[model samples]
Target: MLYRFKSQATADLVMLVADAQGALRLIGKDLTPEGVISPDQLPWAIDILQHAWREDNDLGLREDTYATEQLAEQDDENPDVRLSQRLVPLVNMLELANKAQVAVVWSAS
Candidate 1:
């Protein structure tokens, strides 16, 4: 399954099932079929994502022992780079949506 998040403020952000689920979890959402993040909710979402990112980095999962084969070959990237990149846009999306008094929603496909 795939999860595609959308908002008028930005381009669509598509993520794998596991990745999407994990990110939703990070923002304290259960794995539901679909949901909306209101502008009122975005500030907390941003804080949650930021906190989770810091905690993930603190784990040092980018180290050789914890890294996967692909990461081993890319010395400059962290193990969570892909997840983080996928979500960075969300942070911005949430902020923009907030300013515009809009919402960001995700659908499963």
Candidate 2:
């Protein structure tokens, strides 16, 4: 899976990928992308991404629950303030997409 972030806050873009085993692997040439999302921010991002994926793909509840739990654990050790800060952009992204009524595309083939 792959994710891309584009925003006015920074000139560079952010991209992340996950391998077949669900291990996240950072990609793209621009490491210091404008948005500067840290590894700590990834779980929240993944939570959103996975929710969209499951909804769009009509995934089973069991699968969704398992994934959600796993992703939630990623932020357990993070400071509350840092987690809140990280989630702000993610929530904004979701709101922006929702306002645009964007259709989340899924590939479950």
- Give all TM-scores, in the order shown: 0.72, 0.27
Q: In model 2, what is the error at residue 102, expressed in angstroms?
A: 0.4
Give the Å error, residue 79, model 1: 5.9
Clashing pairs in 1: none
Candidate 1 stretches with Cα past 4 Å from truth are: 61-85
True-structure lDDT of candidate 1: 0.77
* Alpha-carbon runs more than 4 Å astray in model 2: 1-3, 6-81, 104-109
Look at candidate 1 and tell me the lDDT of residue 94. Answer: 76
What lDDT does candidate 1 reach at residue 24?
A: 86
TM-score of structure candidate 1? 0.72
